[model samples]
Target chain A: MSPNVKHRERNRRAARWLLGLSLVAALFFGVRVGLDMVYWNDPKHHEQQLEPWMTIGYVARSWMLDPRKLRDALALEPVPDRKTSLGHLARQQNIDFETYALRVMDVIARQKAATE
Target chain B: MTEVALEWLPVYGLPVLVLIIGLGCLGAPAPASLTLLICGSLIAAGDFSGAQVYVTSLVAAIFFDHAGYAVGRWGGARLAHWRIPLMDRARHMLKTRGGMAVFLTRWLLAPLGPGVNYMAGVVAMPLRRFTPFDIAGEVVWVTLYLGLGYVFGSYVSQISEVLGDITGFLAFAVLAWLLWRFIRSDLKR
Candidate 1:
């Protein structure tokens, strides 16, 4: 109700958000010891392995979302393990080279749709 | 210029490397001027050639400064999420001190360029307001270092001795700050 309460509340949210972010960054960038501590197995190293459902999450995390869209997208049920992780899918079919190729094509199609 | 030490360490050696690694060493425990001064000492002590060390250190300094700048831009508003209290302190410092924060970060504290860049971005400071000061800081900062090194080239040892003392103190200060934060945060939790 008071300004002090509001300021404290805001700072508390900021601190909590920052703490979560640090843990995520630490996990991605590796441990405090050194860069060497970031194992090859770390998920960040496998960024290209992202799946379709995960894009919403990544885009959301990147703060590129249009507010409610991200939350709503993520809130929906995940579409099962369509193809393991993007890792196995890429290995099996080179999705980056293939699917990404098609996604570019899809953009063109969408562009055509927009013009019409 | 020291040839004897360069033989063992190859690009002048480990102290320089560690210095760079310390916060990527781009600027370091002090200002860019102090870095050049310390490198000059290695030259005077016959540790490495002053010119060669200067060139390498300069390249590293420029590269990292710009790199920090670019990365700072990439994170922009997200800098607040960094959780580095120094950055938060810097943000508050900039808010109060205004342009003076840029000068101090570039010189006094030496965390100005990248650290302040991100803080500025987070606060959404105008790029115009940011660039000229940054360029001025870099140009002036660079000139001061190289000038100091060249002027006192012969007395590099004295320069290094003084810088080494200051760096040691700053290093301890940094470690103490980190330890303090760790303890304080733990207490907060």
Candidate 2:
């Protein structure tokens, strides 16, 4: 085959492969996102059980609360930096994180009520 | 620096993200994946929607992947033909396992992704094989970082820092490996 003809043939094959791969990738992304949405919307997934190792940043994300506001509401000293997990903060304050997490939940409840 | 660009993410938006990632893939010293993670953080913050960021990032990455490949084809191949130790080893890697090398560099060792793209081109890996695997690898790379950003938006800065360190360490490790291999081969001869 002429060099030009060979090049054209190669390009066509590559294009076909690209289309196939794109389709597979699109399906994978769609399924993953769809599943995450479904799990999030399910009320069963709303289990509010906070673990000791969770950070205020994490709680804010899970609970859809504002991290900054949560910190201010809890009057958390020295500000809750990203690396500071809840368990460490609870220890600093001489309380178990369960009690501390409950207090945060209560604050979130009051804030919601005030907004409502 | 990648972190500095990140601070401007809220102000500058998607175009900036796309540009930085493209250039970074072409051997620019920007932390591309970390930027994606920050973009994910923005998605979580509701500044840009997930689909929009995902599409933009994927296209940008794939576009640059091809560009780097082309660079390797035209530019890097010349060096591969020379008696260079590093180039020879890279050519060997591309010859032995081009697709898996492409995939691994694309996501797992992302800092090396661009270099691999260029090297794959230098070794004349078929575009039919290279492009599809490049896309698949990018899917994982983009999704993982963006997912992290979405889930851990509040801790994005810290995550960026950690990932940057990991990329740096990996890059260093790769360089060290190349140097060691070169010395060992020299001693054998």
Candidate 3:
């Protein structure tokens, strides 16, 4: 084949390869979107998982508890003007964040149990 | 980096938010949408004010978009002598579908927003035209992500993941379509 014809043939092959790659990527992300929808839609997923970054107010909202009631239950000091995350609360209490989170989670569980 | 930013958000608040949005708009990799989602959750939890987050984020996005555009305009002039095929294609796309491209990239295809801004400036899309479409699109972008977070406060992370996947799917779908068209045209030739 002439050089020009050979160049055209090569371009065609490259274009087919790119098209195949794009289709595969589209399918991968499409499946992920489907799986995420299914997982989040399950009733068990309705409950928010606690994270160290969450503030007391955020956790209270997630758990459907009154922030003040939750704070009083935790026996935390008066609310500071600035919003404080669970990590910050742990630091002030001189405890590890995980331990502090567990203590807070226990209070939440008890409160939920009482309400039920 | 995202973890650190999320942790600092409740403590540092708006400054952190502004920095993230600004960097993201300037084509730096940042989780601006996720931050906006968390801001919505924070507002719902009463740690932040809805109006404040909305206005601050919107302003920051627009300002940084303009900054990206200015950089593109400056650099594009210097690079004008170079005959880059990709630049030519981008210029043609802007000429044909500038408004819709600007609008869609702002929200529905947010990952493309910064690049579109630069291309729009590189092609010298009128500031008058660019401003209205940009502002309108940003309004939708800010409101949609933040509203979802507000309405589904506890599910912000899950929602972010789903949104990311959806965006990726759509991007690849479009790429596939364009590639198919190119192949067909080449075959015909």
Among these predicted structures, which one has the highest DockQ? 3
Candidate 3 Cα misplacement greater than 4 A, ranges: A1-24, A91-97, B78-85, B182-189
Worst 10 residues of 2 chain A by lDDT: A78-87
- Give per-candidate clash totals: 4, 0, 0
lDDT of 1 by residue, A62-111 (tens): 32333234333323334442212222333445555347535533543444
C-alpha positional error of residue B93 in candidate 2 after TM-score superposition, expressed in Å:
1.5
- Preferred candidate (DockQ higher): 1 or 3: 3
- Residue-wise C-alpha lDDT for candidate 3, range B29-113, written one tens digit per residue: 8888888998998999999999999999999999999999898888877654444433454576678888888898888777678
lDDT of 2 by residue, B22-115 (tens): 9888889876877787678666655567898899999999999999999989987566675444456667767777888788778766767877
TM-score of chain A of 3: 0.64
DockQ values per model: 0.01, 0.03, 0.57
RMSD of 2: 14.3
Over all chains combined, what TM-score does candidate 2 have? 0.59
What residue runs in model 2 are displaced by over 4 Å at the alpha carbon? A1-116, B1-4, B84-86
> Comparing 2 and 3 by TM-score, which wins?
3
Which has the higher TM-score value, candidate number 1 or candidate number 2? 2
The stretch of ten residues in a row with the least summed lDDT in candidate 1 chain B is: B1-10
In model 3, what lDDT does residue B156 have? Answer: 80
